[model samples]
Target: MDCPAGVVTDNYDIVEDDELWARIGIDWSERSERSERSGDGLDNELWARIGIDWSERSERSERSERSGDGLDKVDKLDKLDSETVASPTQRSTSLPPELLRATPLYEALSGWCRHWQGSDSEVELFHFSRPVNSIDVFLNLGVFGVMWKAQWKAYEGQCGSHDWQTSRWMKLVTLFVVFNSQAAALTSLLLSAALGFAEVYVGAHVLPLNLWVFCGYMVFLVQLCFWQRIRSCFVAPWMVFLDKMCIHQTNMPLKQQGIDGLGTFVKHSEKLLVLWSRRYFTRLSLGGTASLVYSVKLL
Candidate 1:
C-alpha cells in the first residue's frame, strides 16, 4: 500500500522511503496478517499496550510546538473528549461534604411541601412559628436602607413619583438596568440602616418600645413604597425554617407534617423570597417549591 500524502507515520523510522526498509524491514509476505492486526483505531488502550503514553506525548508536543496553535487545539480536544467520556460516571463521586449532607434533607423537605395548599381561613393552623418581630424579615435584608434612600431621593427630587409611575421607557433593557440600579442603591442604604439597628439591638439589654415601633414603621413604609415596583423580587433575607431547628428532623411523622405546612406558610405570605444558587434548580424539591410559588402567584 502507498503512504498517503502529508501523513506522518509512527513507524516511518522502521520503513524508509528511499532505502525501502534497510535497517528494519517489513515482510510483504505477512502484509495480510499485519493488516488484520492493525484494523482497530488508535485509541488510548492501543497506546497503553504499545508502551506509549498519549498524555506525555501531548505535553511534549505542547512545549515544543509553540509556533502554531495546532498542537494546543489537538491537546484540548483530546482532554475534552476524555473528560466527556469519564465525567458523568465520576461526577457524583466527588460531591462536597456539606452538599452530600444537605442534599437528602433538601429532597425530603421539598417532597413533603410539594402538595401544600393554602385556604383563606387557614391562618397558622400548622405549627409554623412566626418570628417574635415580623419586621425581622425586612430588617434582615437591609430593606429599610432601600426604603430610606428612596424616600430621601424622593425628597431631594432624584427619583420622583413621575419616574416611578410613568411607563415611558417600556423597554426591557431600560427597566432591567436603570430601574434595577435605582432599586439596588435604595436597598444598599436600607441594609446599612438595618445593620446599625442590628448592632444596637444586640448590645442593648432592653430595646425600647420606641425603637421597635420605629423599625416596624420604617419596614411597613418601605414595603408600601416598593410594593408594585420590581426590586428583584427575592430581595429579602431568607427566613430559615429548617427541620432540625423548627421541626423534629429525626421523627418522620412530625417532620413530614411540618414540612407539609411550609407550603401554606408560603401561600398566605404576601412575598416570596428564594435563596438562589446553581444547584437550587437541580434538586426535585426546590424546583417543585419554585413552581408551586410561581403557580400561586399566577393564580
Candidate 2:
C-alpha cells in the first residue's frame, strides 16, 4: 500500500526500534547492555509496559548469550566438587549457580530468556505480511452489513450525505438480538474488509487459520493492529466501534454510558451499517436496537 508518510508500514520491526523504546521511557543506554547479553529480546516487564504478552514476540533461543565472566564464574563453582580443595581466592570467587542466577543482572537477563515462548496457531496468520490500500477500499465499497444497501442508499439520497462521505470515521453497528449468535464469518469478513483484503485472503495469507476455524484472539489482534495503523495514517481510516466488543455492556454503569454515548458516536459518524437479521430485533433490550434508534435520530 502506498501510504503517505507517517502511516504505519508493513514492516512491524519499526515498532521495536529505538524511537519507540525512547517514547516508552526506556533508557536504551542502560538497557543496551541487556541487548548485548540478549540480542534485542523483550522481557516480561518490557512486554507488560507495552501491553503485549512476552510470548507474542517472534520466537528465539533462551539464554543464548551468557557472558564469559558468568560462564567462568559457573566453572569455578564446579571446581569445588573436585577432591582437591581450591585456594582462598578461588573459594572466595566461587558462588552457587542459584545465587548467580538470583543476582539482579543475572535475573534480568534470565527473565528476558524466559519470556513467553509459546506460539498460537491463529496469531501467526494475522501477522501482516504486506500493506494494502485500506482507505481507498473502505471509501469505494464501504463495509459489510446486512442492512448496508438500504442504509447506504438512504444516506446517499440525503442532502448531508456528502459530508458523511468525506468524514474519516464510520460507524459499523453489528446487530443481532442473540448475543450467542454465530459471528465467525461476520468477524472474519469485517476484519478483512477493514484491512483491504477479502476474508479468503486474510485466512489464506494474512493470518491463516486452516479449515475456516477462526480464533477470537486473532480477531482482537487484527482489530488492534488495524486501529493502531489507522491512527498513524495521514487520512485516518474509518474506525469500527463495535458495541459488545468495544463497550462494557455487562457492566451496568459503563453499559448505560456506552448506550447513551451512541448518540454522540453516530453524531460524528459517516456511515452507519446495520447487520440486520432475525436475531437483531429479538434482542431489542440488549442495546443494539437502542443504538440503531438513537443513531437514526441524529441522522
Candidate 3:
C-alpha cells in the first residue's frame, strides 16, 4: 500500500473520516438504543451528545521496527510518545504502591486523554496484574478453567484498574497470585521432602511409603513445569481503557465524554492488541475495529 498524505506541516493534518464516523455512528449506536429503553432524559441526552474530535499527531513508530514514521508531525509525535509511555526504570504497576501512586506511565497516557478531550480532565489508564502463580491457580480454576473465580476477580477488579477504584483494590491481585503460586510450590516441596527422606535415610526403611520415594525427582520436575504453566497466564504490564473501569457509569456528562473519546483513545494507544480471534475484522466491518485498522493504514 503506497499511502501518503497532504503537504508537510507542523501537524499531520490527520482525519478520522470513516473511522471516527463508523465508531461513533455504528458501534456506539447500540448504547443509544439501550439507554433509550431506560427512558431517562439525561441518558438519551448523553447519547445525543456523541461528539467526534480528531486530534492528529505523529505516533512514535516504537511499536514496530519501522525505520521512520514517514509523515508530517512524526518527529514531534515521537517525542510526545516517548514522554507519554513508561520507561524501563519507572517501576512496575504490579507493585501495590506503584499501582496507587502517580507514575510516569500514568502521566503519559493521561496526557493523551487531555490532548484528545481538549480538556485538562484526568482519566485512569488501565494496568495489568502481576505475574500469575501456578501453585495457587490450580487450587481453584474459573470459567475458562483457569484460576479460581475469586482470584480472577482480583485480577479484573481487585487490581484497581479503574479510576473510581484508585487505591481501592491496591495490590490484592498480585499478592493473591503470588500467594497461590507460592503456596502450591510449598506443598510440592514438602511432598518432595517426604519422598526424599524415605528413599535416602537408611533408618527410614521402616517407612510404609518407601515405594513412593522413587518418584521424588519426578515431583521436582512436575513443580518446575507447574510454575511455567502459571507464568503462561501472566498479564503483560500496561494501562488499558477498559470500558467497565475507565468510563463513568452514573455521571451522564462524563459518560458521554468517554463515549465520544473512544476513537481518540483507539487512535492514540501505543499498541492495538490483536492477539485473539475476537472476530476482529467482523467487528471492524460493523464499524469500530474497522476504524482502528483503517486509521492505521491511512496514516
Top lDDT hit: 1
Rank candidates, lDDT, best first.
Answer: 1, 3, 2
- Over 35-99, each residue of candidate 1 has an lDDT whose tens digit, in order, gives 34554223444346445487865664455356344334544778899977834223212222221
TM-score against truth, every candidate: 0.23, 0.23, 0.24
lDDT of 2 by residue, 109-194 (tens): 12221211221122221111112211111111122252222121111111110111211222111211111123434565665465
Q: Tell me the TM-score of model 3.
A: 0.24
List the RMSD of every prediction in angstroms.
21.6, 30.9, 21.3
Score candidate 3 by lDDT: 0.34
Clashing pairs in 1: 142-191, 144-190, 145-189, 145-190, 146-186, 146-190
Point out the worst 10-residue segment of candidate 3 by lDDT.
135-144
Candidate 2, poorest ten consecutive residues by summed lDDT:
153-162
Rank by TM-score (best first): 3, 1, 2
